[model samples]
Target: MNSLKLPDIAAQKLLHVTPLDWVGMCAIALPIQLEGRHVAAMADAGVNLVDGKSRGIHMSRLYLALEQLEHQALTPLAIHQLLADFLASHEGLSTAAHLRLSFEHLLKRPALVSPLAGWKSYQVSVDARLENEMFHVELSVRVPYSSTCPCSAALARQLIQRQFEADFSGEVLNRESVLAWLGSSQGIVATPHSQRSQASVQLRLRNNLDTVPVTELIDAVEASLGTAVQTAVKRADEQAFALANGQNLMFCEDAARRIHQALRELDIATAFTLRVEHAESLHAHDAVASSQWQW
Candidate 1:
C-alpha cells in the first residue's frame, strides 16, 4: 500500500494578505426546532476571516455546526452555543462568528367570536453574533393586522348624518323607522376604508434570558393593534372583526405609537426598533411609520 498526501489549499499563504470581514454561506436550508415544532428555516452562517495570511475559513465547519439547531428548541443559550461552536472550529483563523436564521412561525388563532380556529404564520428571524467573548442576539417578527382610517371613518359618519337628515326631513322620527333606515344601504351611503397592515419589530434581547418570548411579543403587538387579521371566520366573527375595526380606527403613526408603548411595557428587550406599514386602500401609495427606543 502506498501513502498519498492530500492537498490543503485553504492553508496556503496568500501573496497579498488581506483580512475579510465575513466569509461563509447564506440561505442554507435546514430544519430547526422552535416552540416544540420542527420548522423549515434558512440560515446565514459566517465567520470573520481575521487571519489575513490564511487563504480562507473552513466553511464546512460552519455548515456542520448548524446541526445543533435541528432538534433543540431555539433559545438564546442555544444560539450562543452555536456561535461559540463556529469560533471553536475556526480557532485562530476566526475571531468572531455570526448566524442568522429566517423562518415562518405558525400560530393557531381562534376566531373572534367562534369556536373555530386556523393557523397563522408570522415572518420571523433570529440574528446572533459572538465577538470579543460577548454574545448578542436579536429577534424580529412581522405581524399582519387590519387598520381602518380614522379620517375616512369620520367622513363616512358625516355623510350618513346628512343622509339621515334628508331622509326624515318631513316624516316624523321614530325608533322603528330610524332602525330600518339605519339597516338600509341608502342610510349608510359610505363606509370607512380599511386595509391590511403589517408591523415589523426588531428587539435586542437582554443577555439574562434562557428562552425567547416570541409568542408573547406577538400577542402584545396584536393586542395593542386590536385589529389583527383573522384566519377562519364565521359571519358572527366577521361582524365582530368589523366592530373591532370600527372601534380601533388608527393611522400608521398611531399604530406605531401603540406598538412602541406595548413593547416597552413588556421590558423583555433592552432596545427595539419597530415599523408599521399600512397598505392603504384609499391611496395608491403605502403609508408607513417607524419608531425606535434605545437602539
Candidate 2:
C-alpha cells in the first residue's frame, strides 16, 4: 500500500471570491438527551462562510462537532458550547454558527377524571445561533387539543330550549319526567360541533435561563385551552372530557388569545409567536389564527 496526500480542494482559492451566508448539512439523524430522556432527533447544522477567498467550508468538521450533543443533555449551555465548537472548527472561514434540532418529545398524560394515563407525542424543535459573540435560542412546540365551536354550541342550546318548551307546554313539569326526557336522545335534539385542533408556539428564550422549559410551556398552553385531547380514557374520563368541551367552547381566535395570554405571563421567553389551527368538521377547510408578542 502507498500513502498519498489527499487533495485539499476546500482549502483552494476561489476565482469568484464570493462569501456564502450558510454552508452545511441538514436533516442529520442523531440521538440526543433532553430532560433526562433519550430522544431520537434530526439536526440541521451550518455556518456562515465569511471568508470570500476560500473555495468552501469544511463540511466534515460541522458533522463531527454535533457528536457532543449525543453525550450531554440538551440545554442552553450545551447548545452554546456546540456553536462555539462550530466556529472554532471553521476558525477564520466562518463567523456565525446555526443549529436546528427537531424531535418528538413523549410525555405521559393522565386522564381528565380517571387514574388511567398514556404517552403522548409532541413535535418539538430547538433553534440556536451564535453570531458576533451574541447567542439566542428559539423553542417551538406543536400541541393538539379539542375545540368546540361556540356559535354551534349557542345554536344547539337555543334549539334544545325550543324543544323543551314544546314538549312541556301543556303538561305539569315533574322532576322524574323531566329527568327521563332529558336522558332520551330525542330530548337533546342537537349537539355542538367540535374538531381536533393544534397550537403551534414559538418562543425566543431568555438568555439567562439554564434549561429549556419545554414541559412547563406545554402545561401552560394546555391549561389555558382546557380541552386537551386524552389517551387511555375510561367512561368517567370521556364524560368529563365531554363536559369540559361543553364548558370550554371556543373559536380559533379565542384559542390563540388564550395561548398568547398564558405565554405572556410566563417568564421563560423574551418573545413568542403562537398559531392555533382548527380542523373544521363543519366545512372542508381549516380555520386558523395567529398571534405574536415582542416578535
- lDDT (0 to 1) per candidate: 0.94, 0.94
RMSD of each: 1.1, 1.2
Candidate 1 TM-score to native = 0.97
lDDT of 1 by residue, 76-135 (tens): 888989999999999998999999999989999999999999999999999999999988
Candidate 1 ranges beyond 4 A from true positions: none
Looking at model 1, the pairs that clash are none
